[model samples]
Target: MVCAVIINAENKRIKLCNEIIGLMYGYIQWNSYDTEAGGIILGRENLGNDNLIFEFITKPMKKDIRTKNRFLRKDSEHIEFYKQLYSKHNGVYAYYGEWHTHPEDIPHYSIIDLTNWRKISKEDPKEMQYHIIVGRKQLRIWEMRKKCFMPKLVCEVKWDEINI
Candidate 1:
């Protein structure tokens, strides 16, 4: 099966594993990006919703972040519709960040994801500066250098168990 992966360019390993794991464990669905433009998107099926908990990003999300419908790229309306869908669902069943997919509830990101996140993290890797993963069991953070990547263990979270 063909699958996509976002990675950290420096270490070429998975980035933001914890968030990914949480998303997967909860259910199957898409989420949103913490950008200024404000839009929600949908990914492959079997996903329900995701919640992100990050503090800051050095580079805040652009007010004009781009959007594309995986199935209806030709029609911009579809994109707009989903964004509204996300917005309407927000605060209840919706989200506020980018949407991604994984092969299973494995909870890992690809090299591309890491690379992208590294750039985002560079702007701000401060506490609460989290990136969401669409699939997997647990969140995995990768520390990399010079565009090479490797897996770094991060704190594991339980979606089912409520924290005190």
Candidate 2:
């Protein structure tokens, strides 16, 4: 299968891994959809291609709801916070995409997932955007280009454990 590695410049991979694992374990142990978490991915593309260098997992809004297999939430607060952080970092960090978790071992995007992704990407058309769906055993990557969503052939580097 073709892939494009979602390169992490520093400790980003580790940090994201830790977060995903923690979320998974928490959900499995607690038996609740409330444990499901998601956040924004921020980074730059200095090495020719884009890479997700940083991540910020945001808390769901008070009015949001979630399910065992889905994270039905909103990102307004997350977007506001990310905007502030991006400016503080002098544009070095911007919204690249999003990340959310699933309860299965092999993750797959639902139709709703794809639709939401398209909406997010369309809101900002200056550049390409990416999204990640973290499953228990694997994480799937997708990219939005020209208003279309496609599975990204993420070239896995050193993140064999996460199956990048």
Candidate 3:
């Protein structure tokens, strides 16, 4: 586990003790929800940047467009709610990535997942990134810097505890 403070790369593997790391890790731990669909968002302030903690994340509770419609539109309610969150946070925060549940056991991706990731990969490719796939036993994350999405093998992650 790399123990340091780097916000741009959201995929920091650390012992589950720190609150920020633990929160992200903990949020990914729950696979009990019938997340017919969901998404992950990531945000963080540059480390050592005063008290202004530039950290945030957003996930839209989605419809069952059949096992996580990653390309689906965001409902207005989610949009508005996020707007409020952003207003309160005062802009240091960013919408980094998303989390969702699938009907698999080992937390893998589907063809659709690859498609969605491709779009994200096209955007910046170096900024902070986020992703979550809740399978039967674990949740996986896809946080590779500047790598285009690979539908067949999108990300390497596992149950809150990342597979770095």
TM-score of each: 0.31, 0.67, 0.58
Best by lDDT: 2
Each prediction's Cα lDDT score? 0.34, 0.57, 0.48
Off by over 4 Å in 1: 1-101, 125-128, 134-151, 158-164
Candidate 1 yields a Cα-based lDDT of 0.34
Question: What RMSD, rounded to one decimal, does every model reach?
Answer: 13.8, 6.3, 6.6
Ranking by TM-score: 2, 3, 1
For model 3, where is the 10-residue window of minimal lDDT?
Answer: 2-11
lDDT of 3: 0.48
TM-score between candidate 1 and the true structure:
0.31
RMSD (Cα, Å) of model 1 = 13.8
lDDT of 1 by residue, 1-164 (tens): 11223343332222223333333334332244311111122322113423222311112123333332111123345345556655665523222233343444445666666666566445433322234443334333333333333434333333333221
10 residues in a row with least lDDT, candidate 2: 8-17
RMSD of 3: 6.6
lDDT of 2 by residue, 1-164 (tens): 22233444333332233543344333331334445556667654445443345445555556555666667667477778778887887777667777777665666778888788778767885556667666555666666765555545342222345432
Tens-place lDDT per residue, model 3, 1-164, is: 51223222224431122333334443342345443545445354446542223244334444324333233535565456567777886854555555565555677666766666667767854543456565555545565444634432334434434432
lDDT of 1 at 92: 32
